[model samples]
Target: MRLELSTMRRVQRNPPCDHIIRLFEWFYTEDQVILIMERPPNSVTLFEFIKHSKGHPTERAAKVIVRQIIVALHHCNVCGVHHNHTHLRNILINRDTLQLKLIDFGGARLIAETPSEERTLGAVSRETAVRSGCECLYRVLCALIKGIPFWIRLSRECTDLLQELKNDRTWNTLENILDHAWFKEASTVNRGERN
Candidate 1:
């Protein structure tokens, strides 16, 4: 079995975390490997979720979802799994419950051994792994809040944080991301609500 699948299996065996979708079963075949994953009910892609909300969902809603995303990535960091593909479409949100599930490990990697810098894939160090994950997280958050991609008028804190992420001013690691002031923004009102 590949590191990706084995890592997934290890995660599934550990304590349950709602942030990540569970992988029920997996087995290798001569040609291809088969993986059976859990499908969260009443869930839609974050892309669809944003579309239904019309551009951007309330900052509070986005914060909640983004926090969940951070938690999921943090979980991956602890498990030594790097989800290189952290895009809007890769996350699923329950329409009613507002729960989130980070899905699609197709581009995921296990951070067991340090690959040569020449290897063009997941980050090498744990910090860099989570940092890379956060990089993608911010990109997705940008699209989620901006309603398009690489854009936002959401909030000053959010704008600053996004800029810092791009500029590498802050740690850019997932832990620092969770501790960011923007991430701590309380859900008070939906400034971007539109009808």
Candidate 2:
């Protein structure tokens, strides 16, 4: 039943992550379910890139990838959805252009709204719920920038950011975070390293 629901949601939701492959069609047979999605051409996972190139990805390339991911995440959060298992492998890159698209939403969850009174320690303010989502975005970008292992990084960042969303004091919205000098500085550092 859970599988059935997941399959249905996959077809129905049309999640906004362009990096993620969208489910175009689905069917249920007597014994199983079949799902069809658009196949990316010459796709490579970020994990493969890290493995092949070792831990050092050019800072420029990393920033481009991270920026695209943040954009996608920003969109997802606006729609009240969160991908619980975002990681390097879930991001697919075009070999020619290095364009990134987030993929795989089997672990996505609809973010529940929290009451202002429920905001606890480490929690961002009610007005900053969007910023809490951005923190999640930052954690993933930071992990990639630092060359942290995908699985370990994703687990730690997701857990920590989710906690922060549930409890931070100075939380701002996603737009505010993106506008901050710190994010620009980090991105610039990454870009500089590429050169």
Candidate 3:
């Protein structure tokens, strides 16, 4: 099945999560397919958001943004989908609510459809596919956090984890990195605070 079709199927089956872009409906004919989605009046792509900021997101903001992205990826994994493209351009943020929405599932693939080599441990699991996606995100986040094109002058925690991500032999999952001392410590402190 087409990636969009599979994505629609998985999304519709799951309970709504604010971090995922809502697909209202779709139309298909011999020539074209149309996806009607929810778009807030004032919103911009994450790329534009970052570019306009003209500065890196703070540690606090980065944590929140990363957490939301992780949540969205988790939902996709639970529904058996993998968002192959997890970059800034495909993500949107509501200017007012500051809510994140993952869009453009054209690159998304069902976990079951992925080639065996791409799957972690040569087996399919919700965590593996989603964590694989996180590999992309980790790089981006590190770059943003350090305001550099490469992971240089980053915190010790980020540097160590980034090394793990780069090591093919390393089995560190995205969930494992998220629960690392860096992010977990932040979560513990912000548990009761509201955005």
Order by TM-score, highest first: 1, 3, 2
The sequence of per-residue lDDT tens digits that candidate 1 reaches over residues 38-152 is 8899999988887787444666666778789888888887776777778888899998878999888777776645556326554456766767876776787676667533342
Scored against the true structure, residue 146 in model 1 reaches a CA lDDT of 72
Give me the displacement of residue 156 in model 3, in angstroms. 4.5
Question: lDDT-based ranking, best first?
Answer: 1, 3, 2
Score residue 18 of candidate 3 by CA lDDT.
79
Angstrom error at residue 74, model 2:
1.5
Pairs that collide, model 1: none
Q: Candidate 2 has which clashing residue pairs, if any?
A: 19-101, 19-102, 19-103, 20-102, 20-103, 122-167, 122-168, 123-167, 123-168, 124-168
Off by more than 4 A, model 1:
54-56, 112-123, 148-153, 170-172, 185-195
State every prediction's TM-score relative to the real structure: 0.80, 0.61, 0.74
All-Cα superposition RMSD per candidate: 4.0, 8.0, 5.6
Query: lDDT tens string, model 3, 122-194?
Result: 3355555756766766765764565433322444555555566566334434455566655765333222223
- Cα lDDT for residue 129, model 3? 73
In angstroms, give how far residue 86 of model 3 lies from its true place: 1.1
Q: Report the lDDT tens digits of candidate 2 across residue range 1-195.
A: 334336335434544456556667777888776777677888788777666664565445555676676666666555555555567787787766777777676666555566543344222333444544555555655555566433322233334433543464354445444454433643234222324
TM-score of 1: 0.80
